[model samples]
Target: MLLMNEKIKASEVALTGLRGEDLGIVGREEALAMAREAKVDLVCTSLLSSPPPCKLVARGAAKQTDAQEKKAERIQGGAVKTKELRLTAHIEEHDYETKLRQAEKLLTSGHAVQLTVKLAGAKEGERAKALIDRMLKELAPHGTRETGIQVSGKQAAVKVNPA
Candidate 1:
């Protein structure tokens, strides 16, 4: 959680200016006054540090920066990539083979695969599930089924992870 502007209650804070310059430790009131003068917000960044580190940020930029940092972390943190493949219940054999190859390639490259089979009618649900089961069987060597067939109103889905 972030405490901004007047919501910050620490008596003193280690401040950093808006331009990323260190402003050193200062009184909380002084930091708030500087933020007010600069027409920005006083945000407490690290409440656990000595004097509680604070920084000057434009209104709403704190959350934006946090989101950007999280996105960067996710990209750099070896997050697993999930690829979705959509199919129809009555797919052609050639198309099925193509999709199977694509899935196998994805699994070989350490990506998770979500297989979705769309049903044209209520009666097609069983066929879609059977198709997924057959695909899972064929993909057993390349990947392991992470989830059983999940049938919603008009779609059946399954998840597979690399072996």
Candidate 2:
């Protein structure tokens, strides 16, 4: 989840989204108090900001408006945007099937899935490669990779699109 804070305080100087660096330690009420003390409304700058939280301030009549904005955002992003599913090198059949089912659900809705694999050592690397290979095969039968598998240290990611 991400919090957005847009300072729309024209009547007064608002400091919106002041909880980016200090996220997780503050709540809406706390944020509101922080904004109110600062004389502004808490507006979300980037609700889905990779870090998962952001806030700002503006002096306006947007009290608890963050609720509405967040709700709307949740509905939109939650239902529409891409979703990811994770699998380890030694993932079992039932677990793989489950995650695949979930990924298929998202893909059927025109959403992308980022298949991520985590590895440990050389032995784990071989297992990771094997798991990734099998996943690619399964996905190939039903989907295609828009982005090829990429490795970032011990993790590999590929963007899959439904066929």
By lDDT, who's the top model here?
A: 1
Number of backbone collisions per candidate:
0, 20
Candidate 2 local lDDT, 6-117, one digit each (tens): 3322222223354435445354556666766877656655433432233554555445565567545645665445678888878889998988788777766557788888
- Residues 21-91, model 1: lDDT tens digits: 99999999999999999999999987788799899999789988887776556546796788999999999
TM-score of each: 0.53, 0.46
Q: Which regions in candidate 1 have their CA more than 4 angstroms from the true location?
A: 1-77
Which residue pairs overlap in candidate 1's backbone? none
Candidate 1 lDDT: 0.91
| lDDT against the true structure, each candidate | 0.91, 0.62
